[model samples]
Target: MTDEHAPATPATPAVPATPAELVRRFADRLADLGLTEAQAATRAGMSIAYLRRVLDLGCDFDRPALLRLAAVLGLEYQELVSGRPEERLHAAAPDADSAPLVGPPLLGELTVPECWTRLGPGGLGRLARTGPDGPVVRPVGYLVHDRTILYRTNPDGALAPDANREAAFEVDRTDPKLHEGWSVLMTGALEYVTDLALLAELPQPPAHGRWVRLTPGTVTGRTIRTASAR
Candidate 1:
């Protein structure tokens, strides 16, 4: 009888597989093809003796034989061997322009340090808020690093009142005319840094950017870019 405490099987769901598992399963399936061992060996481009030797010794055929066997079995060679989309097998490595997108309006979430890191030296983020009054958006430069986010503002801007509170920031790069590009949104608690000396040391200035520290409580974000721009 089943043990009541036995872990239940998980619900059926799509899953990704690792490479070695693919190789082992393929070998077992090859063993059942409609052919004698000698015939299978010959078609797989191996000497019957060598095939029998490996079989007796319990080793699967090497990659070359597996590849030839796949061909004889009408399989897509690259997909079976590399475990990636056959289309990508011939394509260059993924990048901003060639990568498949996660999906449209790619909604996702990720944890970050108290401060968001530099998106790059040129990265900028926009702060948006919906208070008891309503919604507002403003572009701001950021000096992000481990454990803290830094930036300059009115020191009493719309976002200041929301400091040490929950809020969201968004950064996006998209081609509106052609309806492409990506957008990223981050949500978290916002904390304002009041130490003037610390703010004085932050790296912010396109000439006059100042520093303010924000200790993020939690960060959840997602990226949405073109599939072509992986």
Candidate 2:
């Protein structure tokens, strides 16, 4: 039996780039066809969770899982097995750091409710808190209740707890061709829900153990809605 987490015969990392780079390299091609992990999984005749786990496990991905992922990702199986950068098969790598769908200087004020409607579990948000370490961003699941947004993030997510005590969470989806999409940002003060009982009151699965509250103020957002390249 082989472990998916460990390399078959490890020496070092594959890409000078980060795992994020690898994930990004494939995201666009996936999106071009309006494909997501869900769609890819279906095409590959596998489950979404299984595909997700394979990508998440990357270097440690097993033979069968790796094979399935490569097929679904429009990659050749031998390339995945080789783990060689030159052999890298994905072609959608970004020339620069920019979301795929954004083209021009599209900007405006959007509301928190408007943003929340589009933003969900997959997007990451940065937190500004009282701590001296400064802001940090991480992916988080989100929920809304009575116009208030709640996020469950790690304790270390806070930057300067008392001083800023707020978070700026943003999510956007782009389409370089469709020429349009939207960006949503929510700025508000956050309070730690340290109380075990009160924490339970937050709307989430029982598996989520803790989180914080964001009472939004001066909410803002922006939407491209549509754009034309020609």
Candidate 3:
């Protein structure tokens, strides 16, 4: 007689051996995350057509594209490419004096000029302003122009600040492996950009939206160095 109370065995995922199989595996991962092809492509900063083409045609392995896709899928690059889970060893504590003692992290304040230097051709930053509900912080792509912070936002969006309202913007960079980083903060009056001439002078046109400028009243920065080379 067959047993009626046997536990169901979990199905094993198939190992991918070909380009087409790998793409299918990627699709499976997206499904697991409740994401669609378009969503995954968007998060990977690639076009939907490109994603679909890969899925259909099974192109050769592209490292850059695969890396971005792996990040979006929340999988390690090796794990995604090899169709196997990443193997990581638990780090063991080092014995006392096993290695040269790199003294405690050195913290230092940055000068005004140094702060500007650190902000160099900005990438992304946090914009803080008061919204209809309360204080709000949003991530925004920004650039340092004429010693002021320039960013784009929807005119009616929650991130858009009132005319000449006080706001704060911050940018930072860190390397987890190196245990070193720097952060710069700016407090200023935020206002909508009405100067078309100034906008034209920018290296590139801002995204289709209202351009905002933050004229900082005070700027401050700090840096932490854990390695001797810094």
TM-scores for all candidates: the values are 0.40, 0.42, 0.52
Candidate order, TM-score descending: 3, 2, 1
Worst 10 residues of 1 by lDDT: 1-10
Count: clashes, candidate 3: 0
Worst 10 residues of 3 by lDDT: 85-94
RMSD of 1: 20.7
Candidate 2 per-residue lDDT over residues 5-79, each given as its tens digit? 111222333343334544554464364333456666776777877766655656555557667666654455544
Indicate the residue-level lDDT of 1 in model 2.
8
The candidate that wins on lDDT is 3
Model 2 / residue 140 / CA error / Å: 1.9
lDDT for each residue of candidate 3 in 1-230, tens digit (9 for 90 to 100): 01111112233343433576667678777654445677678878889987766555433545678778877766656556555321111012113113342678778787788888766545678998886689999988776678998887887787676764689999887644435578889899888777889765443434557778899999998877564322
Residue-by-residue lDDT tens digits, candidate 1, 13-57? 222233454545455445323224555566677887765444343
Query: Candidate 1 or 2, higher lDDT?
Result: 2
Root-mean-square deviation (CA) per prediction = 20.7, 14.1, 14.9
**What is the lDDT, from 0 to 100, of the residue 36 in candidate 2?**
59
Pairs of colliding residues, candidate 1: 96-229, 97-228, 99-230, 115-148, 164-190, 182-224
* Model 3, global lDDT: 0.66
